[model samples]
Target: MDSIPSGEGLIARMIEGDESAFTSIYRQYHPALYTYLLRICKIPSLAEDLVHDVFLKVWEIRHRINPALPFTGYLYRIARNHAFKTLKKLAYDEVLQEKVLEHLQFQGNGPEQMVNEKEYNRLFQEALGRLTPQRLHVFRLCRQEGKSYDEAAAILGISRNAVKKHMVLSMRAIHNYIYRQGLVITLLYLAQKIF
Candidate 1:
């Protein structure tokens, strides 16, 4: 029910800033790209965001796109890179949150504590932004909302094992990111839990 455009012609029009050509390319590739990202990250929302980011990057670099080259491959490479970067950032933020939480434990629970709590909340949001939509939902339900794995699974309509898997992978990513950031002292605590 859909028609495919000539890649070379589409790229040429995109280079010249043709909105219609860009739209054509987007419509053609978006579904595949989103599916690919969702499979790798297991997050529907993140997949959509990655697709958006990939297309935006494509547009920004349209002038440089080689019409003679394989467009699909080039676009996929960009998507993969974007996904990796997003994952890394998410991991780093998770570790950073742990560090912040540890520091908060030492401070008196008062106005200063409230200010730190606010900062923690901000960082928590940033970390969540890095996760795929499904993963974010799972994390919030399980951790933030204080729901059990079974409860989250029922709420999300996923298996209990699926919920556990997401949590483990998410926590592992956070620990690995913290280790990579050279936070040795914090890593010690995280490693115990992650390992």
Candidate 2:
């Protein structure tokens, strides 16, 4: 089974300039963080690039991210800020995806590629949107933003157990949807990554 080192230890190591720890952190948080960015930036490639950029910033400002503080919140704050800035500079429309992608140093696929990724993203975001608002909020806090259950619970005014339940329900719903569509192999790989 795959495992993530404990958050505090990882944060301490990262604070001490351990690249391995930061890499582990980047891998651990990549999926949810990327999805969150995709929802904002509305493009897979841009989201992926933003994830890399966010980590680069994190590594550069490692001293500011206190090991004693929750790194998850810090990470999400950076992502949200970067994504918002990107959205504003690009003027917040389909016309802007390519421009933002270019500024982010990615391929400039005019409209067709953008359309396809946006279509898939629409379905994916819709799936996430189907959850109860509280559940969706918790899922975003815990999975999408990499917050610990307790931390998320505190942020959302819920118990830790509720946080765990929302996460399980979100995963179960997504994997079941994927399975019904006969995407078991792809779902299995995603499962391997997140779990």
Candidate 3:
């Protein structure tokens, strides 16, 4: 079995500019974070780039990280925020969006890819369905419709901070739902293979 390192210890060391601690954190979190970002961006190269970008940002702000708090959530928040910033830019840039679309279209996906896409879409929808009605509405407005937080707030007659809070909660809920579902699927596959 692989041993899990002490996150707080590693983080504390990283705060002291320990390269090995930072590398350990990167090794521990990279795969899952990359998968998560890939799902969000739908581009492998961009997701890989975003992963590096996130790690670099983490290293830059290591001193500010709270070693007492769970590092996974903090790391994920950074990754999510970075990915969303890139996506927000993509949403505003028609040329970039067209290029991304063209790139995706150029990639010839096989049947396996199709099945994976369907599974991902199903899990994503299920996660969305698990959100509260208000949270769901806020998510649709800001994420799906590409509305700004302020615009979403105006539409819902709520404060912008409330809209932002809803969006953050909704995203956390969605990520947790998908992660749970993924674990279940993985376990089921393992069981089938074993039995």
Candidate 4:
């Protein structure tokens, strides 16, 4: 019967780039880490991916692992950080997809409007580009992304009132920009309807 190495020995072996030591660590910790991530992320595939990412990071930073500290605690911290980052990216992707869909729908229901829609889209992009990065992010998160004020606030690390204020100001600026473009009243109506 073979005994598993102590945490200290395993850490040293991993720092030396021992594949078997890394495998041993993975086999010991992967299940618990997967379960913890699954509980936090609530998506099986995402949880599995995060667990894999955590282990990959651990392997990459193996030399930095401190054997004197609680290895399990360190592993969990890595898993937690990976899960949060993955979640944030997923949320951002979802929001971007929604914005694209909204833009498509706003274009029109018929092919006859294609040329006008293309020009309008160009101008709209320009308007968006004119916004300060922070205001643009806030607007996208709160308006185009359809996130609630609280959700935007939490994600942006700002107060709920601040999110509301940014949304108000952002919408006003976009409205004024479109109005100045002399596009049409329908464009203004569409903008108001969408945001």
TM-score of each: 0.48, 0.47, 0.50, 0.48
Top lDDT: which candidate number? 3
* 169: Cα error in model 1, Å: 24
Off by over 4 Å in 2: 1-4, 92-195
lDDT of 4 by residue, 71-138 (tens): 99899888776665554454336553343234435654322243366766776787889989988999
Residue 170 lDDT (model 3): 94
**Candidate 3 pairs with clashing backbones:** none
Q: Which lDDT value does model 3 have at 26?
A: 92
Candidate 1, pairs of clashing residues: none
lDDT of each: 0.70, 0.69, 0.78, 0.71
TM for candidate 4 is: 0.48
Two-way TM-score contest, 1 vs 3, winner: 3
> Poorest 10 consecutive residues of model 4 by lDDT?
186-195
lDDT of 3 by residue, 40-141 (tens): 766788889999999999999988999999998998889877876776566456664554555544775322233366787898999998899999999999
- lDDT string for model 2 (18-134, tens) is 888888898899998999777665567778888998999999999877788888889988988876665544433445534443533344432323334555465567678778888
Clashes of each: 0, 0, 0, 0
Error of 4 at 13 (Å): 0.9
Candidate 4 yields a Cα-based lDDT of: 0.71
60 Cα displacement, candidate 4 (Å): 0.4
TM-score comparison, 1 vs 2, better candidate: 1
Best by TM-score: 3
lDDT, model 3, position 179? 51
Give the C-alpha miss distance for residue 139 in model 2, angstroms.
53
